[model samples]
Target: MLGPETLSTPPQSPLVPVLPAYIPPDVDMDVVLAEVAADGVSAAPADESGLQRVVADAQQQGIDLKVVVIDTNPPIDTPLRDIATVVAQSHPDATVLVLSPSFAGTHSQVFDRVTLEAGEDLAKTGNPVQSAQNFVDQLNTPDFPWTGLTIVLTVGVLLAAVLTRMLQVRAKSADAPKPQADTASADS
Candidate 1:
């Protein structure tokens, strides 16, 4: 499994840049500002000071910021819960997102309970539209369900082969036992 550091780093820019820095005149600044103002911040703090940066930024903006902390194989004495408590105390409105990639089952349940009680949104993060599209595409793809057209074609070929073999076996078995009578007459 990839460590928290790997997941926390923002994906590097592609080999080719997708967009230029300047915005065209046709684009409305108000709309852009609104989008920017509404945008949420995501972060993974390694320590208390790192966590403070996000809370401070959200407080300054007067908008709720979502904080995500990723920890892999954290120790029992880790300050994750304490950090979360501090964040909630400092920024009551902000939602903190916590993900534990290394732990599953009961460990996740405990985390979920804590996050919910604290009024935070806890889950793995990614593009929702892309995630939905991927699921839809997988369902639509030909190979997912094995009992579709491909299976029917394969079964038809196998049945045809079995019938052909049965016919050949019957024809050989049905041949007369004339040679036995000839041998008996020769012996007589």
Candidate 2:
């Protein structure tokens, strides 16, 4: 019978640079961080139960887990990719995942490249906190990011066109002169 100590382990290799870095092969998670941390690693809020559990699990397995909680409001100039790059620089051999929360919803990255959003079950539940928590719970799962952004953008464009047409019609109607009553005919 296999036990924890008797479990088979994979051979370790020197970390190498990978391209199109979406979801690199499995390695023990060593660091977690937000995009803005000057150093890829830092203390984050204990409220994130999923992250906390990951840290604890790593410790139990004797793997060094570094946690970096990203800033709630990241700078407009700093994108997710940039943050991941920064984290990678700090820990070249380390695997980086970004867990971001927002009022709209929550999402995470795997392999530091592939974007995976939380399932819709939480969002439809109408609880922001719970929805965000649901997002955290599904962070490590093999899911794809929602493509609703494209649809949303398309809707926005269509709406703008409709509004512009309505304004043009209104302007033409307002500019036209009102028909005057024939006072002379009435007097005759």
Candidate 3:
């Protein structure tokens, strides 16, 4: 998870552009275009100013600002990957930032679940960035993925302890000397 300062810092290396090789059939260009427009991006291939607007909007929405604008459409199955690969191949060390409406769904889900578990109202966070950071922190917690294996191991340890205690108690009682009753002399 990136802090606000890290997000604001410009990338040290130049970002390499990667476009999707194929556009998925299900991708609705009109919907995509409308979303772009809403982001204040007037052109498919956003110019410098348009990119800045995108970065600003994303920062406001609590998204990473290292963006890789995909000018052309890509296959639905690997839309984000196709673009990422291109940039990755050219700039192996650079981070790939994909901006798409599709991402909004999953991001919201992550934020919601994290906030729910924290017992905090999402609105109280006051910004998308904070919400996103909280979600990331939740994910990074040491016991984040509490797996079935962990549960089983814990139960096994507890059962062993109880059984050991019970055996110790039984052995101690069995080893004790039997109690003897004293008999009084019979009356003449």
Q: Which numbered prediction scores highest in lDDT against the true structure?
A: 2
In model 1, the Cα lDDT at residue 13 comes to 69
Superposed on all Cα atoms, model 3 deviates from the true structure by an RMSD in Å of 17.2
Q: Which has the better TM-score: candidate 1, or candidate 3?
A: 3
Better of 1 and 3 by lDDT: 3
CA RMSD of each candidate after superposition: 19.4, 19.4, 17.2
Relative to the unseen true structure, what is the C-alpha lDDT of residue 163 in candidate 1, on a scale of 0 to 100? 100
The true-versus-predicted C-alpha distance at residue 41 of model 1, in Å, is 7.7
- Listed in order, each prediction's TM-score against the native is 0.24, 0.30, 0.33
lDDT of each: 0.39, 0.44, 0.43
- Candidate 2 per-residue C-alpha lDDT over 1-188 given as tens digits, one digit per residue, 9 for 90 to 100: 96667667886656533443423332112444332233323434443554556545544644333334444533331343444455656555444334334322212232332332233233223333344335334444655445777888889999999999999999999999999999999899
Weakest ten-residue segment in model 3 by summed lDDT = 101-110
TM-score of 1: 0.24
- Against the true structure, candidate 3 reaches a TM-score of 0.33
Model 3 C-alpha lDDT per residue in residues 132-155, reported as the tens digit of each score: 344334433555555888999999
Compute the lDDT for candidate 1. Answer: 0.39
Query: Residue 35 deviation, candidate 2, in Å?
Result: 14
